[model samples]
Target chain A: MTGLSFRYGERVALDEVSLSAEAGRFTALLGPNGAGKSTLFSLLTRLLISRQGQIRIAGHDLERQPRAALAALGVVFQDATLDLDLTVAQNLRYFSRLHGLPPRQAEQRAEEELTRLGLWERRNEKVRALNGGHRRRVEIARALLHRPAVLILDEPTVGLDPPTRRLLVDHIHQLCATTGMAVLWATHLIDEVDPISDRVVILHRGRIRAAGDVPVVLAAAHSDSLADAFRHFTPESPPAQEAC
Target chain B: MPWLLALRGIVGREILRFLHQRERFLGALVRPLIWLLVFAAGFRAALGVAIVPPYQTYIPYEVYIVPGLLGMIQLFNGMQSSLSMVYDREMGSMRLLLTSPLPRWWLLVCKLVAGVAVSLLQCWAFLLIATLFGIELPGPGWLTVLPALILNGIMLGALGLVLSSTIRQLENFAGVMNFVVFPLFFCSPALYPLYKMRESSETLYWICEINPFGHGVELIRHALYGQVSWPDLGMVTAVALVLLALAVRGYDPRRGLMKRKGG
Candidate 1:
């Protein structure tokens, strides 16, 4: 998708943002906190529609063919969307059915996706019983059940431990490598970006500060480390209390 | 297929949530049951009953109040669902649902329909229990009550939708109950007829005439006796349409609902 924009009243959330994820490539939508990454996801996924720009998923315009575009994309939201009262299998089955899969096909796919996420054994467990990491895995599995050509994860590892986060990121990298599906993984964590498989886009205060290969983008600021590169783009600002 | 699936998913989630919270279901039953068994029994002698149009012969006060009790449960459930929606919005699950590819209006309608279905189920269950207490309507009247229940469900559910969209947080919901629910219920023909009020005060009669909730209660009242009132239907339909439109507008992203979260 290119040139997608959004605003909340007078304040802009995304300003003429442009990026692309070629098939089989993993693209990390990196930014600092409050850098409009979540807003961009809201725009691309049709949570908040903006008439000022265009978004195409797998060659379909979102506004003209929202269902077709949405069907082609799978998303794991930052928050756990699984119904806590439902079993993992039930949750996945519900999503599968929502995507128009037949009941038999949906059940089989739910099982397969759960197994893929190492959640098959816990399929019957209610989401309330699962830990934070396990619940996130269930969400990822639920997203993949429809087998979309593109996967979008918004801060997928926000609450996980370091090892679990690395494992989740590696799992996503492997999925992209094997399926040739495009991936847009949004996160503030600099270390999550795979130097080989992903391109990086840095957003600052609703604007893209840089976009390109991770090494090249990081190199532009005379910084070898991704963390330093991120700091270079985003500097701490003094807090100003609004006049009463 | 997608629509059916979406409907099922939304409805299933609502039912599962309701089932998990056993207290809510029990409260739905107990609240109306208390009003029927205790409150009604206490007031039956003090409250005089006149022959209303729905009554062919002189019916007891307990039988006359059943439809109103049903309306009360539906209204309370509707508001309860609104509270749940507000809580979901605060908890971020609402964003998950809104992000789905379905049209915003369709998703909202599905949510309202889910609430309606839950309210209807509770209504039916209450009725079955009430039957055991020797409160019975005409055999065909039960069939007639279906349409009334559906209409009342939509009206009340639409009101809940409006509240969910407009209210910023679940914590502020008490003000809504105090300002909206209490007044609508008391001013309406649910507890007493308009003519009964006209005897004592003209203002009360006027308030009942304009109270849309009264039309909903009257719809149930007439339907329970195998009667259909065109005026009540018209008023309920108009109110439902207006409330639903306001709710859809209130939930529109550009205006606030979702955007207000950051603020």
Candidate 2:
């Protein structure tokens, strides 16, 4: 999909924003606060409808085939979505079932994914007892249980420590590399957008200020650091909520 | 397939949560038991039962009102579940369920079914206790009450779903209870039959005739007495469908019910 735009009343959240994360690529949606990154994620995931633009997930038009589009995308929401009352295994099993997995396969997949996340030891523990980082791992594992072609994570490492964040980002990149899946990872942290492996799309005031290879975009602005390039392109005091 | 899975997932989540909160189950059972045992006992001498339509011979006040009392428990539990939905929405969990790759209608139906299941369990438990208090129904009344409980549970749960989706925040729920619930209960034929209301106020009797809660209570009364009131059943079913449709419409993302004030 291309040229997707959205507005809240008269104020715009995305102004003719066009970007794509092709298969086997990790696309980082880089923007400062209030730059409409979350709004863009909302459009791509079909959480919020767009009157001005469109989105296509895994070759399926979101508007024309919403269910198929959603089915093709595995999303780990910015906020925690785990059922706090359920065990880790129960949570994954339920999510797998929601994706139409049979009961036996769902349970098997749940165990396999939890084991991969280093959470098999705590599979029977209630989600409420898990620490924040572990809870995030559970959510990530749950998202992947469906095995979608495109994985979208909105601010997945928001509350994690630096080491934990790096681990998650590495894990995501490795998964995309091995599975040849497209990934749209939205975050405000500049360092999280790797200069070598990932593409960068910078959003500023509901518009795409720059979109290309990470180093190329930064070099075009005559900046060496991603953070400096982001500040230069995304205006201060943006008129939107972007604390993703 | 996806819709079925979504239904099962949401219902399973709700059931698991309910099970974990043991106090909530106890609280749901205790509230109605108090009214059935204590309040009915104190008021039995003051209130006289006229031969209601479902009644063949004059019944004691406690026995006559048991069905209504059971309906009240389910009704309140439905609202309580709705209250939790609102709370969950505010806390960001309901969004997960809503955004699943399933039809919103199916997700909602699952919610209604889960609520009805929990309500049915509570109804049976309440019936067993009430039977111990000499408030007994026909031998096959338990069999008949199943359908009645299902109908009433869906109707009440649908109302709760609509209320939860329409309300923006949790703080406004109390006002909803005070404004919407108390009037609905007191103005219905739960406490007194329409014929009894006619002796005091013809206007109220007319009001009771139109209230959906009255139909629900009467449906339960008919079933508990081994009689079928097809009209009451039809009315409750129609209301349930209407309410469920509205709730689905209100929660649609194209016109999200969670609009902010002055937006």
Candidate 3:
């Protein structure tokens, strides 16, 4: 995405924001509450159109070729989007059909994804019967069923336990590494960003405060820990040298 | 072909959800049943009817109100479908749907089609109950009314889509009931003939005459007797098309109500 900007009436949600994620890399979008991370995700997913910028997903411009762009993109929103009454496999199959996959292919993909996520045994259980962690896993599995070129997750670990959060973070990172899929993981939790993250984009007040490789962002902020670097870039912090 | 597949998936999901919520099915039936059984029995004596174009002879009050009650089922079901749309938005499922690679118009049309499909089921169920109560249509009337019911279902469902797009929060749905559903149902020829409304008040008679729901009921009522009303069908078709376009525009994220709420 380049020069993307959006406003909700008078309030600017994202202002001239431009960022990119590379395939086979995990890019962390770190921001505090109300910092426009969700807005950016909304734009990337084409849920909200950006009037001021261009977004290209897998070489398909969002505005010019939305179908192709959206076809290549996968998203797991902050809230659980699964039909609670439907079973795990049923939810995945529904998603597969939404992507226009044939019945045989959809069934196979659902099996493969559910098995990969370790939810295969409970595939027949309704989603309402599953725990929160399992539900989130189902959503992640559903998102990956289409084998999208880019995966966008918005604050995916909001209510999970520490162990589950760690597990999910690791699983997505593994997906990035093994499948060569670009990932934009949005979270306010500083711990989710570690030394392994290929790139970090810190957003504050609808603009990019710092964006670069982990080491470069850390060095630019002159902070040893990511937590401190994040604090330094936020609006609440006192004036510091510009990191961008 | 892909669009067809997605349409089938969406429509199938709606049917599954409808089946799961047995209470909704029951409620959709009960509302109109009461109007047909108890209310129509009382109104039968109080209200007298003359030979209308759709009816060659004076019909019983219950007979006149069956088409109206049919419209009521679609009306309530349509609003209920929109209520679910608002709930889906709150629960984030609507976001998943809107982000599909298909054209946005096609997606909304799929939703409309699904809503119409469910409404048709409810309509048939009610008709069966009405049949059990000794109210039967003319031979072949049952088959002929299918197209009219489908058309009316699309019209009402499209109106629901328009409402769902404008209503930002779930809490505001009751407001839709008061402002949209009640007015659209009460003011139309669904409950009474337009000439009867004219006898009471000219303003209301014109209002009912112009109401698309009134035209829908007229179309269904005529078709229920194995007759046709080209003007009523044309009116309903035009209104459905116009409202459907408005619904599509209302959901457009860039310029529609979704943008206003920053969804």
Best by DockQ: 3
User: Which candidate model has the greater lDDT, 2 or 3?
Assistant: 3
True contacts kept of 2: 0.47
Error of 2 at A11 (Å): 2.2
- Cα RMSD to the true fold for all candidates: 3.9, 2.6, 2.8
Worst lDDT run of 10 residues, candidate 1 chain B, spans B254-263
Superposed model 2: Cα runs more than 4 Å off: A237-244, B258-263
lDDT tens per residue, model 1, A1-244:
6777777778888888888877888898877777888788877777677777788999999888987898898999886777888888877776775676777888888888788888899989999999999999888888887788899999999878887888799989999999999999988887788777688887888778888897888789788877777778777722211111
Clashes per candidate (backbone, < 3 Å): 0, 0, 0
Q: Model 3: how large is the Cα RMSD against the reference?
A: 2.8
Interface RMSD of each: 2.5, 3.3, 1.9
Task: Arrange candidates by DockQ, descending.
Answer: 3, 2, 1
Listed per prediction, chain B TM-scores read 0.97, 0.94, 0.96
Per-residue lDDT of candidate 2, residues B65-132 (tens digit): 77888788888888988998898787766766766677778878988988988888788888888888
The parts of candidate 3 lying over 4 Å away from their true place are A235-244, B260-263
Question: Candidate 3, A74: how far from true, in Å?
Answer: 0.6
Model 1 chain A is weakest, by summed lDDT over 10 consecutive residues, at: A235-244
* True contacts recovered per prediction: 0.34, 0.47, 0.58
Most accurate candidate by lDDT: 3
State which docking tier applies to candidate 3.
medium
TM-score of 2: 0.95
Cα lDDT over the full model 1: 0.83
